[model samples]
Target: MELQHREIPVEFLQRLPDGIKIVKRHGKEFMVVEQVLGPGGENLMSDAVHIHGEPSIRLGVRINGQEGLIFVDAFWGGHAKLYSFVPDLAGAAAEVDAFVPETRASLMVNRACDVDGCDCTRSIVLTLPDGKSRVYVCARFGCPGHAIEIADLPPTVSQTISSINFFGVGGSEDDWLDQF
Candidate 1:
């Protein structure tokens, strides 16, 4: 499916919360996650692993009873992930239990994914520097479902920002986007 790139809401840019920033890539502006914390306030940004030329958000995850490390893209609405160990996702709706790699604090929240055809009821929550703002990602592997909630911004603005997918749906790395 073709991914639609939505313009970043001006209100959000004016009141951009901490831990998230706007970046210029190929002369185009994009929102990126600069930092995120686990439930125990452990920094989940890994400088050692970079995705899309930026530090990745690292997390420990257990999928289908197999535990491993996952480095995720920091770009907002991006779903690129690198797994330390291959997960045997028997089906598309497989769920994951995500936690802090250092403190093991649970990052899973009881939130249902809004993506159609996906029945995942759990989400991985990443707290932004502002504390009140959060980024929620669907726990189901291969599901590009995520949402952003900013404390000061309107819910509609946050929702609109959450819908920006640069690499297209399913996080397909199409080189065509690089031309922009």
Candidate 2:
């Protein structure tokens, strides 16, 4: 979909932390923290903060800098939390994960923030049971469009391709010919 990006104020950028990037998509903006890790090469979250043992699942929240909304997906109870950023105020912060070569390497990859306003680069495509497909981005947290289906996309947008695709549908003429 076409979106008119607003000029992000300098003050707004100043309020955010380093390594975070601003991305505008479908008419909204989001603040994305790309690389987060757990002890077992999984995403880390508030409730799931532990330095030992690999849990079966990981969790995180997608932050919307504009509205101060934090969107967590089904895994994290599927809710949005309100948070305001104060440049002068210091609070609890995210610490880097245990830095082993393997853990550190895993942290380098983007987890695809699928939130509406986030601009995370990593995405994993999933094919639904009904033969439809979607893309999940922003591994650091959960938000709307974090797990969006291809069929739900606007008409102007024909296909959604990401760095990873669960469905092995090739980019062949037969695979995408009907989309046009």
Candidate 3:
């Protein structure tokens, strides 16, 4: 199936529970996508923003950075928070997890801030169920903390390829993720 993308703006977010926070001190919302861990990961397709953990079934959110995979051990409760460059929120809705690795991610991306438009660029290497790793580039942007998933999904593009880089923070297979 061809990977499709959708863009949700900060001005169009829905209301969470009574006391749920949705924004960061800096105030920047990003298109966030999550995959739930399977016995070892998260239920990515389901937005368990409120209930994000299954201690017996730990899920993780691994950001593909310039250096390598930065895996964060996510939980289902306690200290739930979000970070952003926009300043207007106490914190955004996110799964409660004990951030692992305890280090900053190395993101050598072409990030920019525009008045009405912006698209960050990067490449990702996704390992499929079969242990076969394929690169993916997010084609669009999504709202952080929202759960919208497409599973058992195959790389719509790239053949006999090494890597691919994608545009937009949400990913859309438009970029190439490579290593050679």
Candidate 4:
């Protein structure tokens, strides 16, 4: 399926685990977001997100070995239970349970430019721990995933990835992409 690039707000990304990228935003400039991959790793958008005055959008990322059972089942539609798989550490921080609706908001909240002015093309990618990336095109008019339905989305996002404010992470875009 052709993924349509959708715009999202900044606040939505804040709900994630951390280390997610705001990429860029400018006074309501649109941040691109998309459902790009199946599992493991996926980018939030299909292409770059451009706002009129900002440089970031809201999004959380998660991947293999991190997401707990609730997120795993709701997002991937799989029967695997992370909590059950590793019962000893059931209450681990990484194993924190996320409300399905709030989880979907992280992705669907930004359906268009906050001002209804401009929504740019974006790309999404899923990066596995192995250091490989899988790209997906952001949806145009993204599906407003219902709170009840969000329980079925793969929790491939985390706050740790977005909260990464590398002091000397270099000010160049290429510098960041290189790390991914």
Candidate 5:
């Protein structure tokens, strides 16, 4: 898959949410999640596990009946993840139940994914520092479906940002970051 670099919407930049920030790499700008919270307000960013030189969003996950931790890349539209244990199933077959590692509060929500060919009905919701904004990720393993909702920004801007897939569809594990 080819790498895609989406331009950040100017409107989003003017009113950037609290937990998200932009960083430049090789003269290119990229959005990164600085902080995220669980439903119970538990901090999800872990400095111990970094991805692309930024702290990863840590979550406890139960996949295929096995429980473990998942450290997800903090980069906006980036789906790179490090799993503590190998999952026995893949794709739509592997259902994930995510939670706060500290509070054990579920991050799951009953929201259908908008990605084509993905029939996932649940998502892992991560609340931004502002509380009103949220990042929703598909709970189906290997599904690259996510959406962002910012209270102060227009839906179109959020949708455009959500459509960005830096490593391309289903190619989150690619080493595109190393090239930068």
Candidate 6:
């Protein structure tokens, strides 16, 4: 089935996880997934890991332009979780995550972008004044890039950031993808 006017295919729905669905509002396309839950049975979105799940982690499939660019915004959890097993979803999948530098503008050591089917670790870090910074894109050109954010960085990175005294870092090891 196709959405009104946009003619964008709806079959992509079959490619996503159970809790995720797509919707169009005001001519823009968006994917909406239920917020994940925390270990204590609390709404993690309201406590820690705010705005990192659900509609925040959008799955964008190209409508016409390049024909297969699947763009997913930065999300919490490991990139492996983001890489779905769905077939025929073409084009490169671009994902972004956040990271915090230990020192001012310190060079980020090379780490492979962990998004499934991707192997790039090089990234361009954009540091903010409050240490809430983001890595814009993959260092490699054209392939899908993983955006590294403190909210979404792997557990090891999160632990490291907290150890260094970065501000506004939260997301327990027990954070559930269903708590959004």
Model number with the top lDDT: 5
User: Candidate 1 or 6, higher lDDT?
Assistant: 1
In model 6, where do residues sit more than 4 Å from their true spots? 1-109, 151-180
TM-score of 1: 0.92
Write one digit per residue (lDDT tens) for candidate 3, span 1-180: 222222222232442122113332124322222222222222323233332231121222332221121222122111123332222223332112222122322212222212134243332222223333221322122222111112333322122111211133444322212100
True-structure lDDT of candidate 3: 0.24
Please provide, for model 6 over 1-114, each residue's C-alpha lDDT reduced to its tens digit, 9 standing for 90 to 100. Answer: 122222323433333333334555456554433442222222212222224343332222222132221223323222212222233324354333322211122223466654
- In angstroms, how far off is 72's CA in candidate 3? 6.4
lDDT of 2 at 73: 21
Error of 2 at 137 (Å): 3.9
Instruction: Tell me the TM-score of model 2.
Output: 0.23
Candidate 3 residue-pair clash tally: 30
Instruction: Give the per-residue lDDT of model 4 (tens digit) for 29-65.
Output: 2222223322324333212432222222223433233
Question: What is the TM-score of each predicted model, taking all chains together?
Answer: 0.92, 0.23, 0.21, 0.18, 0.94, 0.26
Cα shift from native, residue 129, model 4 (Å)? 9.6
How much is 98 displaced in model 2, in angstroms? Answer: 19
Q: After superposition, how far is residue 155 of candidate 3 from its true place, in Å?
A: 4.7
Q: Which segments of candidate 5 are over 4 A away from where they belong?
A: 90-92, 169-172
Off by over 4 Å in 2: 1-119, 142-147, 152-180
> CA lDDT of each candidate?
0.86, 0.31, 0.24, 0.26, 0.88, 0.33
**Candidate 3, superposed: residue stretches over 4 Å from native:** 1-51, 55-117, 123-129, 133-180
Ranking by lDDT: 5, 1, 6, 2, 4, 3
Top-TM-score candidate index: 5
